[model samples]
Target: MVVDDSPFSRTLLADSLQQEGCEVVGEADSIECLIETYRQCKPDIVTMDIAMPGADGFECSRALLAHDPKAKIILVSSMKDEETEAEARRCGVVGYLQKPVEGEVLKKVIEGVMSPDVLYNNLQSWSIDIFKEALGQSITRMTKTTATFVEAECSEKNISQGITVVIGIIGHYPGSMILDISKESAEKMAEVILRRPAKGQDEVVAMGAEFANVVGGIACSMLNKKDKAFSLRVSPPSVFYGAQTEIASPGIRLHCLYADSDFGRIYLGVGFKKGSVLWM
Candidate 1:
């Protein structure tokens, strides 16, 4: 909930909080209806302004605290007086912010007050980052060559022919990591990792699958370690070859990226049915 005498300021504050993933339950311009509104909404946190019609923020905060001692309130105002801030603290305001607040700062303050939602958001945002870091390191270590990673459009049309390695993920959310590369690229990777010429198509399949496995395993391990809620496990890689093989999953969202290696380009996609759909 947000309480400010100015409707414009209140709306601006509410919009900023919403952008940071905070759900504003209610808004108020006066203290007359604040108590009843608070009781009705039971919001997680309340942001209060110093200048209101009837009573100032401090008085309203004190009154609310008197009613419910556990009420979480944050004083947000242009007024910056040490004595006033001290009085707010004395009344039970958990945080104090000046007139303008940055998005990240607002998020941090809210995170200090309530952490579960922020933690979940952090996990979902980090999902794409896991794969981003994993693939760069996996190829660099295995092939002893640096790769250029860049954001790419993610869609079913991007799925191409040649060597494709599919690795299923189970835990946290059921999804899969798909790796696509040309046969020549697979052979080059296999030969480089093997330190010799890849014998045949069998060697290409084995090496391609192993490469995908390394990426999926490292990425999932990072994700699982991020939080207890994400107990992600990477499945064995399934190798497919040629354009005749078709892959389809109707109800999953995909995030795609490509890395350019010394030998060839490698495309990686992570698909899941749930969690943060838009990657930041």
Candidate 2:
């Protein structure tokens, strides 16, 4: 089951799950619809939104859990932070995913619920060692705000596979991060972020550029956490043309792999070092 206000999100999420051979039993646009559907279907898993017209995903999950404690609800939204994640955890939600939903991420959520051992192992091994830990104060701010989410898209690339670059920014204080990708990777990102394949070939590239910009603004705000005080500024994003371009900056770069997608070489760059172009 999926509960979201956007018909686009519902269709995209359902299509992606179906492609992975998972059965999506029902789709609901509001809390009332979800409650009614839940009474009838009792789906094995549910992907719900944080914000809704009447009763949000959180409230609906709580009501259902009141009847059956073992319900596995996954909170899915464009919002991310310690506070939001903690709230979902308190509600007994099994997992949390940031928007926009991608096939690999959705599959992982399902598999994690079905198999606890896999999730535990991944959690244990997932390290914060390589990435720069944003300042303690900044992290604290992240917990209090509604801005901890990103939406990135890449442009088209002739290369069959793609690369993801995560770039971090640092000022007199901690700043933000950016994940740059090839145009093809960006479009694929759009397909994932928007949760659907391109209706027109041009949309992927166009939307992807906007995705990077918007995601950067959101991330910068989230990372700063003290936006009212610090007022950090985001630099304009730059696009690289070729497939072989590397993130050669001195900051840390972490490589990641995505399932079911050909975008190869995901790089996570950390910190905006001194002497680099610093946007106020």
Candidate 3:
């Protein structure tokens, strides 16, 4: 299956897969449709886009993984982020690929994962020590939420004003991290883009998205290079303003609390859905 919001991307992926002598079973432009298709067709592998219309690839991957822990989902996107890659592993994905993907590369990765030896080798390649190092630069545990989640309860305090970013990272070597904070958090992050404070909701989302972008980018690099590459793909960050409901999945949600003078509540949840061991 292929899940992407861009019509051009979907067509290109389908054509490439067919050229590789692989069958293109189905395609979806949004998360809801992708889930429905997954239920109907249990394809051996899935190549999903990082960004989508409604749910996005990250949310879609989690939903699919929740239903089938061993689901062979590959994240294919232009947006590369460390947090996204880390989340993909936590989500139990079988593979991850970057955008402008070549058909040969996709074919090789798909065939490689099917082999028990290759899978073992890939797993051996992922290292946690290196991940800490790569992300260690701006890595700080959050006690409060960073303007990502609508409403987040943290060790330091509760977020009430501004926007909240709620993100879930799922995979082996796994976990989920939510950055909850206020509008102030978004404003500070905007400097990276506009060279100044963000002035509106659009600016805030862009900044917040960039924050996710950085986290996901670093995570992807670590996952690909640490020891060797394993199947991992990070989804684009989803940002929402105001208070929202609790988002849940089947994996062991690990929350990391980082709070200080900068961003507010940053909660990260670490969850594991051991391969071949999940009931759902």
Against the true structure, what is each candidate's TM-score?
0.55, 0.44, 0.44
Candidate 1's C-alpha runs over 4 A off are 1-121, 245-247, 275-280
Q: Assess each prediction's global lDDT (C-alpha) against the native.
A: 0.79, 0.55, 0.59
**Which of the predicted structures, 1 or 3, would earn the higher TM-score when compared with the native?**
1
* Alpha carbon lDDT at 122, candidate 3: 51
lDDT of 2 by residue, 1-280 (tens): 8888989888998999999989889888886676788778888988888887788778888987887787778888888887886777678887677788777667765775667554433322332222222322222332221212222232222233233323334332333344444566556555655668777645654554454445455545653453222234556555543456544434323222212224322233333322211111
| TM-score pick, better of 1 and 2 | 1
Candidate 1's error at 84, in angstroms? 58
Candidate number that wins on lDDT, 1 or 2: 1
Cα misplacement distance, residue 123 of candidate 2 (Å)? 7.7
Q: Using TM-score, give the best candidate's number.
A: 1
Model 1 C-alpha lDDT per residue in residues 195-224, reported as the tens digit of each score: 999999898889989889999999989986
